[model samples]
Target chain A: MRKKRMINKFTLYISLVILTFIFLFPLVWMLVSSLKNEFQIFRDMQSLQAFLPPAPADVEGGYFHNYVAAFQRVDLLRYIVNSLIYTIGIIIFGLIVNSMAGYALARFRFPLAGFWLGVIIATLIIPPESIFLPLYVLVYDLGWVNTYTGLIVPFIANAFAIFLFRQFFLDFPKELEEAAKIDGCSQIGIFFRIIVPLSKPVFATVAIVLFINHWNDFLWPLVVASDESMRTIQIGLQYFMNEPPIKWGQVMAALTVATIPMLLIFAFLQRYYVQGLTHTGSKN
Target chain B: MKGNDSSAEKLENERHFHQTAKKPQLKPTPPPRKKRKLKSQAFREAMTGYFFLAPALVLLGVFLLYPMGAAFYYSFTDFYILTPDDVSFIGLENFKYIVEDAQFRQAFWNTVYFSVIVVPVQLSVALGLALLINKKLRFRVFFRTAFFSPVVMSLVVVSILWTFMYNPNEGLINQLLQTVGIPPQPFLTSPDQAMNSIIVMSVWQGAGFQMMIFLAGLQNIPNHLYEAADIDGASSWQKFWHITLPGLRNIALFIFITISIAAFKLLVQPMIMTQGGPLGTTKSLVYHIYETGFNYRDVGYASAMAVVFTVIVLVITIIQRVLIKEERG
Candidate 1:
C-alpha cells in the first residue's frame, strides 16, 4: 500500500511539471522568437530551437535586435506613454471619487444611500461593452470622440471599484474614525489622513485591477482613438500586425514590450492582484 | 465525520456574508433635538455626505446609466449615427430587422455555443488546478505563476501570438503536429475548426483567473473535515463529493454566472485573429454589433443587439442570485 501511494505521488509531480510547461510555453515562445530575425524564427520553428534564443550568427542585430527594430518600425514609446497617461489618470481619479462614495455609503446617513447602492450594484451586470454604442454616441455628441477625454473620463467612476471599496470600508474599524473625530479631525480629513493610509491593501487591490484592465483595454480604445496619434499600445500593435508585410520578429518584440509591465506587476503585487480577481472572494 | 458541525457552520457564515449587506452604519447619531446648534450640525453632516458622493454619482449617472437608457430608447428608433438629427421612433423594427439578419442569428448561436462549451471546460480546468496547488505541494507559487502568466498578457497580445502559432502553412502548431506524427490541420482557415481553435485558446488564457478564485474558495474549506473523512475511511472520491464539492458550491456558482456573462461578450479574439473567419464562423455578437455600429454606422440595429445582450446578462445574474437565495432559504 505504501509503495502504491509512492507511485501516485511520483505521477502527480510528473504531470504537474508537464502542465506547468504547457502553460508557460507560449509566453516563453514569445520571448525566444523576439530575439531572432524573421528568417531564423521560421527556420527554427520545426525544431526545439524555436524556443531558444538565437546565436550571434543568426541575426545582424544582437539578441536585443527585434526590440530596437520594434521601436524604429513603430512609435512604441508614444503609444506606451499614451496608455500610461490614460491608465494612471483613471486610477488616481477613480480612487478618490469611488472611495469617497464608498465611505459615504458605509458610514454616512446620506439620504437615498440604499437606492444608490442598489443602482451601482445593478450597473455591475451591464458592463461597458454591452452599452458601448450609446455611450460612444454620447461621447460623440459631447465632441469628445478621438480625444483623451473620451478615453479617460467615462471610466473614472467604476461601479466595481465603488462596490469593492464599500465592501472593504463596511468592515473598517470605526473606533479609529471616532478617535480621530475626538482629535477634531474633519470627516474628509479623517478619510484622507486615516482611512487612506490604513487601507493600503484594498487600495492596492483596486489600483492593480484597474491598472491591468485599462492597460489591456483594446476595444474601447480601438473605437475612440481613431487618429494615429491617439492610438493605445494594443490598437497600435493590431494595426502594426495587420498592416501588410507582417514582420514576425518585430511583432513579437512589440508583444513582449506590451507584456513586460504586467509580468512586473504580477511579480511584485501578486497578492493584491489576486485579491482583485477573486471579488466574491476570500478576505485573507 | 467529527468535523461536520464546524464545516457546516463555516459554510453557513459564507452564505450569510453573500446574502447580507454590510453591517449597520458606524456614525452614532444622537437623538434629534430642536436646538439650533444640533440641527445645524446634522445639516452639515448631510451636506458633507452629499459632497463626497456627488462626483461619482454624476459620472455614473451620465456615462453608464444614461447610456443604458439611451441604448434602450435608441433601439426603438432609427437612430443613425450619420444623421442623428433625423430620428423616428420605430417600435420593434430594429429588433425585427436583427431577428431577420442572417449574420446576427449566426453570431448569436455561435456565442451561445462558445459559452456553453467554454464555461464548463475552463471552470473545471481551473478547479482541478486549484485542487492540485491547494495540496501540500512544493513550488506552489511557481506553478501558480506559470499558469497565470497567460492571463497577465493582454488578449490582443495572446490573439496575435496564437494567430502566428495557428497559421496553417508554416505555423508552429502545425509544424509541431507534423513532428508528432499527426498531419497539419487547418486551424483558423477552416470554418468548422476555427471556433474550436478559438475555444482552446480562450480556455487556456482564462482558466488561471478562475483558478485563483477556486484556490481562495479551497482555502476557506476546513482542513479538519478532510482529516475526519480520512479517519472514517472515506475514499478520495467520496471525500471530494461530500466535503470539497459542497464547500465550493457558492464559488462555483459565482464563477459560472460570471464566466458565462463574459463569454457572451467574445469579440477581440475573432476580430483580431480570424477577422470573423474564412466563412464568418467566428463572428461573435459583440463583434457583429461593433461592425454594424461603427463599421456600417447603423446605430439602431447595434443598439437593439446591445439591449438583447444586456438583458441576457441581467437575466443570468438575477436568476443566479435568486437561486442562491432560494437555496439558502
Candidate 2:
C-alpha cells in the first residue's frame, strides 16, 4: 500500500512537470526564436537548438539585433508611450469615477441608487464588439479619432470596476464612516481621505484589471488610432505583422517586448490580479 | 416660593439658550425652520450621491448606452461610411441580407462552432490544471505562474507567435509532430484545419485564466467534506463527483458563460493570423463585422450583425442568470 501511494505521488509529480513544460513551451519558443538569427531559426527548427540563442559569430548585429531592428522598423518607443498614456489615463480616471460611483451605491441612501446600479451592471452584458461600429462613428463625429481623448475617455468609466468597488465598499465597516462624520467630514471628504486609503487592495484590483484590459485592447485601438503616431503597441504589432516579407526574428522580438511589461506587472501584482479576478468569478 | 420661582425661571432660560445657540434662527418661528433645514440636509446628501455617480453615469450614457441605441438605429438604415449624407431608413433589409449572405452565415456558424468546441475544452483543461495545482505540491506558485503567463500576454502577440508555430514547414509544432513520426499538417493554410488551429491556440492562451478561477473555487470547497468522503471509502472519482463538482458548479457556470461570450467576440486571432482564412473557415462574427464595417465600408450591414450579436449575448446572459439563480434557490 505504501509503495502504491509512492508510485501515485511520483506519477503526479511527473505529469505536473510535463504539463508545466507544455504550457510554457510556446512562450519559451517565442523567446528563444527571438534570439536566433532568421537562418538559424529555420535551420534549428527540427532540433533542440531551436531553444538556444545563436552563437556570437553567426549573427551580424548580434542576438539583440532583432530587438534593435524591431525598434527601428517601427516607432516602438512612441507606441509604448502611447500605450502608457492611454493605460494610465484609463486607470487614474477609472479608479476615481468607479470608486465614487461604487461608494455612492454602497453607502448613500438616495433615490435611483439601486436603479443606477442596475443600469451599470446591465451594461456588463453588452459586448464592446457590438458597439464598436457606432462607437467608432461617434468618436469620429466628435473629432476624437486618433487622439488620446478618443482612446482614453470612452473606457475611463468601466462598469466592472464600479461593480468591484461597490462590492468591496458594501462590506466596509460603518463605524469608520460614522466616526469620520462625528468629526465633521463630509461624505466626499471621507471617501477621498479615509475610504480610498483604506481600500488599497480593491484599488489595486481595479487598477490591474483596467490596466490589462486597456493595455491589451486591440480592436478599439486598431479602429481609433488610424494614424501611425497614435498606434498602440498591439496595433503596432499588427501593422508589423502585415508588413511584407515578415521578419520572423524581428516579429518575435517585438512580441517579446510587447509581452514583457504585462509579464512584469503580473509577476509583481499577481496577488491583486488573482484577488480581483476571483472576486469577479465568485460574485457571479 | 420665591426661591422655587427663581430656579424654575433659570431652568427655562437655560433651555431657551440651548435651543437658540444650537440653531441660531433669526426667523420668529424656530420649529418649521429647523424642520426645513433637516429636509434640505437630506436633499443635500442625495445630491452628493448623484455628484459621486455623475462622471461614470455620463460616460456610460455617452459611450455604451448611446452606441447601443445608435447601433440599433443604424442597423435599420442604409448608412454607408463614404456617403454619410445619403442615409435612409431601410427597415430589416440589412438583416435580410445577413440571412441570405453566405459569408455572414459562414462567419456566424464558424463562431458558433468555435464557441461550442472551445468553451468546454478550455474549461476542462483549466479545471484539470486547477486541480493539479490545488494540491499542496512543491513549486506550485511557479507552475501556476507558468500556466497563467499566456493570459497576461496580448492576444495579438499570442496569435503572432502561434501563427509562426502553425507554419507548415519550419514551425516548431510541425517539427515536433515530425519527430513523433507523424506527417506535417497544414494547420492554418488548410481550410478544414484553420479554425481548429485557431481553437487550439485560443484554448492554450485562454485556459490559464479560467484555471485561476477554478483554483479559487477549489480552495473554497471545505476539506472536511472530502475527509468525510474518505471515511466513507469514497473513490477519488466519487469524491470529485459528489464534493468538488458540486462545489465548483457555480464557478463552472460563470466560467462557461464568460468564456462563451469572449469566444463569440473572436476577432483578434483570425484577424491577426488567418485574416478569416482559406475558404473563410476561420472567419468569426466579430471579424466579419469588423471587415464589413471598416474594410468593405458597409456600416449598416455590419451594424445589423452587431445588433444580432448583442441579442445573442444578452440571451445567453439572461439564461445563465436564471439558471444560476434557480440552482442557488
lDDT of 1 by residue, B188-306 (tens): 99999999999999999999988999998988899999999999999999999999999988888888887898898899999999999778899999999999999999888889999
Clashing pairs for model 1 are none
Question: Which stretches of candidate 2 lie above 4 Å from their native place?
Answer: A54-60, B1-34
RMSD of each: 9.3, 7.9
| Winning candidate number (lDDT) | 2
TM-score of each: 0.93, 0.93
Tens digit per residue, CA lDDT, model 2, B1-329: 99999999999999999987977665565467888898898899899999999999999999999999999999999999999999999999999998899998899999999999999999999999999889888998999988887897899899988888988987889998998999999999999899999999899999999999999999999999999999999999999999999999999999999998999989999988988989899999999999999999989999999999999999989999999999989
Error of 2 at B184 (Å): 1.5
Candidate 2 C-alpha error for residue B97, in Å: 1.7
- In candidate 2 chain B, what residue range of length 10 has the lowest lDDT sum? B22-31
